[model samples]
Target: MGYALTFEGLRDLAEGAAVLGTGGGGDPYIGRLLVEQQLKAGRTVTIIDAAELPDDALVIPSAMMGAPTVFIEKLPSGAGNIAALRALEAHLGRTAAATMPIECGGLNSMMPLLLGAQLGLPVVDADGMGRAFPELQMETFAVYGVSGSPMAIASDHGDTGIINATDNRRMEWLARAMTIQMGGASYISDYPMDAATVRRTAVPGTLTLARRLGAALRQARAEHADPFQALAAALSGTLYTHGLVLFRGKVTDVDRKTVDGFARGHVTLADLADPRDQLEITFQNEHLVARRNGRVVAIVPDLICTLNSETGTPVTTEALSYGQRLTVFAISTPDLMRTPDALDCFGPTAFGLADPYTPVEHLTAVP
Candidate 1:
C-alpha cells in the first residue's frame, strides 16, 4: 500500500517508536518536530517498500546519537544528519539509492525522514531491529553479516569521521569517543548494504507498524479510552505493571565523569509512589538497571521505561532528574526481540550484571 506521510501520520509514527524503544531509545519529540519542520518547509519524504530496492542499492541507516539531555540543552542545527550520509556516500565511492532507520524507536525513527526529504530519496519502511537496543552491534543486520563499519559520523560543527571497525563493538566504542569530542552528540550514517543484504537482515515494514501503534494509542485517548490499554491491545501485549515515578526533582546529586568516552551517571528517585520506596537507576547513556529498596526490579533485555506521570510519555535516561513525578511501565518484548542471539547482545551479563537472564514473565510470576 502506498502511503503519504502527513503531520498526523508522523505523530503516530513517533509514538510507535517510543513504545518500541523499550525505555532506552531517546525521546521522539525532537525527531517529530524535525520531521514536521521539514514537511512544513515543503519537504516530504517518501516511504518505499523494501522489496522495491535494487539488488545493488547502497543503503545507510541515519540516526542521532548522544544523551537526550544534551540534545535539549544544545539544539541540533540539522546539518549533522545529512552530512553523515553524504560523507558515507563519498567514502564508499557509491551513491546511496535509499535510506532506512537503523532502528525505528525514539528519536531515531524520524532521523532519516529529514534527510530523505532533503535528498529526495525514498525512506525504506523498515529497520534493523523491531525494537531498540543500546549498542551498535545489537542489530539484526550485524547478525546477518552486515558490517556497521565503513560508516561515517558528522557533527553540526562541520567535523566528520569515517568509522571502519573490524566489528560492531569497536564501531560503537569509536563512535562514542567521537561523539564526546563533538560535544556529546553527533549524527551517524552506517550499515552500507546492498539491497540483498537489507532484505535479508532488516525487519521490514517497521515504520508502518510504528505508525499504526502510535495512532492507536493517540486515537484511544482522544476517544476517551485508555491509551496504555490501547497500545497493549494493538500489539497483542499487556501493560505488565504501572508504578510510581520516583524521580522528578532537581539534581541533588550527579556524580558524572567520562569513562571510556561515555557519559556515565546514576540518579536517585525520591518522590516516588512510596515515600519509603526510594529507587536508584544506573546508566551508561541508556538506563541499565532499576532497583527499588535494594532489590533489582528491572534490568536489560527487559525494558525499563519511565514516563511522565501526567502525560504517560516515555522519558530518556538522560532526562531523568529528581522531583519529577514519573510512572514506570514494563511491557513484554515482542517475540522477535526475545531471540537467544538478540538477548545475548543485550542480556543482564552484557551489562555486567552477574545474574543469569530471566524473562520478565518469570520475574512477574506468582510466587
Candidate 2:
C-alpha cells in the first residue's frame, strides 16, 4: 500500500532524510517548504513501494546537482525539475511509468517526490543511495552498471540541455560541466532503467524508511521519551542497522570552505560530560569520516550523523555551528556498498583518504 504525502507527513520524511543524509544532502527544511508549496497548490504525491512496480515498468531516477549551499543564495527555478524529466522522457522515447530518488538524503530525496506530485506520477519507495553521497558516479545505479545518460539538465531561466554519455563516469563529468555553465545548482534526470534493473540496483524502501524514521522521532518528542533511543530503534534493521551513539557534546570548532563546487569542512565536538572525549567529523557535502578520541571510528558507506542533543533536529554541514550541543551517531551501510567493486568506487580511498575501510560494526564492537 502507498501513503499520500502531506505537510504533516513531511516532518517525518524530513527528519528521516536528515538521518539518511548523514550530514550532507542539503537542508531538508528547504526541500519540505518547496514541496509543501506544491501540496498546498493541490498536487498530491503518493509514495509507492518498489515491490508494487511491474517488472516491465519504465522508471526514471532524478536528483539535484551542484552545491547545496548555492540553493540557499539562489532558489531553484522549480520548473527545472519536470523540464529535465520531460526532456529525458523525450530522449528515451518513453514516458516514465514512475520516478524515484537518486538518493534518500537531503534535497534530492524530496526532488523526485516533488516531480512526482507535480507530474501526477507515483514515486518509487526506493533510491540509489540508502544514504546521501556528494558525487553522481557513486550511486548504486552507477556501481551496478547502469548508464548515466542520455541525461538532461534544466534551469528555471528556461535553459535546458540534453546529454548522452557512453558511461556513468563520463555522464557525471559532462553534467558537472553543464551544471557550472548553467548555474551552480540545477535539476538532473538520468539512469533511466526498467523495474527489473531498478530492483537489483536501487536501495529499496529507503523513501518509506525515511518517512517512518522521521515519524519515529516526531512521536518520541511528542511522548517525552529519549529521541536518541527512538532514533536508534527506528533504524534497528535497515542497512544502517549497526546504530551507535558515538558521543554527545558541544561543538568547539568548525573549519569549512567551498571547493570544486562542494562544501568541504570539519566539525569538532567536545564531550559534554568530559571535554577530553571528543569527536571530529570531516565532510565533503556528506560526512565522510568520524574520529572519536583521536581514533578513527566511522568511515564512509556507513552513516555518520549529528543531531541536536536535546531536540534531535539534524544539523547540516552548512548549518553547523561551534556552540550547538549535539549527539553524533553511526550506522552500518548496506551490504551492496561493501562489495569490492562498490568499495573501489565509493570507499575511503575514492574520497582520497588512506585508511583501509572498516565497517562500523567492527569499530563499535563490544569487547
Candidate 3:
C-alpha cells in the first residue's frame, strides 16, 4: 500500500530513523528540518511500497556522504542533493521514477523524503542498508552486486562531480575524497537501479518501521510506560525481532575525531550505581562495537543505539558528550544483513575488531 507523509508522520519517521541510525548517519534533526522546509513550501512526499514500483521504474538512492561531526558544524545549503540528483539524471539521460535512501538511518533516511517532496517523486519504502554503516560500499545493494557508480556528487556551493569507478569500493574511496574536498560533506545520488533490482536487494518497509518505532516511543511516554519495553514490543512484530538494553549509564569519556571523512572514536560510560562497571562503544560514524567491562556485549551488523535514558530520543555520535545519562540499546539485524557476504562488508572484522561476529541475541544471553 502507498501513503502520503504528513508533518506528524515526518516527526515520527525522523525519531525512528535516529534510533535505527545506531548513532550515525548524520543528524536526523537536520534532515527533518530539510524535509519540513519542503512541506512548508507546499510540496508533498508520497511513499510507496517497493512492490508498487513498476519493474522498469528507475530508483535513485540519495544521501549525504561525510563526517557527521563536520556535518553538524557545516550545515548543508539544501541545494546539494537536488543538484546531485539532477547531475545523475543527466548522466543517466533518464529521469528517476523515484528516490530512496541508501540507508534507513538518521539524516540519510530523510534525504529521499526531501528529494521526493522537492521533485514530486514517490519515495520508496525501502533502503539499501536497514541501518547506517560508515562507508558507501557497505550497502546491501553493493553486497548483492549493485554497482555504486556512475554516481554523482554535489557540494553546497553547486559544485558537482561524477564518478564512474571500476567497483563500489573504488567508488567509495573516490566519493570520500570528493566529500572531504567539499568541506567534509557532500550530497550524493548512487546505485541507480531499476525497481526490480531495488526490490530484490533493498531492506523493505524500513520507512514504515521507523515510523512505527517512533510512534511506539511516543505512545509509551504518553502512557507513562517504559519506552524500551515499548520499543521491544514494536520490534516483535517486525523483521528486526530482538531489542534489548545492553547497558544504562552516564557518559564519562569521549575520544572522537574526524579523520578520513569519518567520525572515528569511542565513548566510555560508567554504570549509574557501580562506577567501576563500564561500557565502551567504538565507532566509525556509526556505533560498531559495544564492550562492557572489557567484554564484547554487542557488535556490528547488529544495531547498537544510544538514547536518552528518560526520553528515549536517539543521540548521535557527534552529539555524545561527557556527563549525559544514556542507555545503550542493541537490536538484531535482519538475516539478510547477517549473511556471509554481508558480514564481509560490515562485520566486526571489517571494522578492524578482533572480536568475531556474534548475534546480539547470543552475546547478551542470560546464563
Best by lDDT: 3
TM-scores for every predicted model: 0.86, 0.97, 0.99
Model 1, residue 196: C-alpha shift (Å):
2.7
Q: How close to the true structure is residue 207 of candidate 3, measured as C-alpha lDDT?
A: 96
Please, what is the whole-model Cα lDDT of each candidate in the order they appear? 0.74, 0.86, 0.93
Which parts of model 2 have CA positions greater than 4 angstroms off? none
lDDT of 3 by residue, 12-66 (tens): 9999999999999988899899899999999999999888888999999999998
lDDT by residue for model 2 over 205-316, one digit each (tens)? 8987888888988988899888888878988877667777888899999998878778999999998679988899999999999998878899998899889988788888
Error of 2 at 341 (Å): 1.5
RMSD of each: 3.7, 1.3, 0.8
Is candidate 1 or 2 superior in lDDT?
2
Number of clashing residue pairs, candidate 2: 1
Best-fitting candidate, measured by TM-score? 3
- Give me the overall lDDT of model 3: 0.93
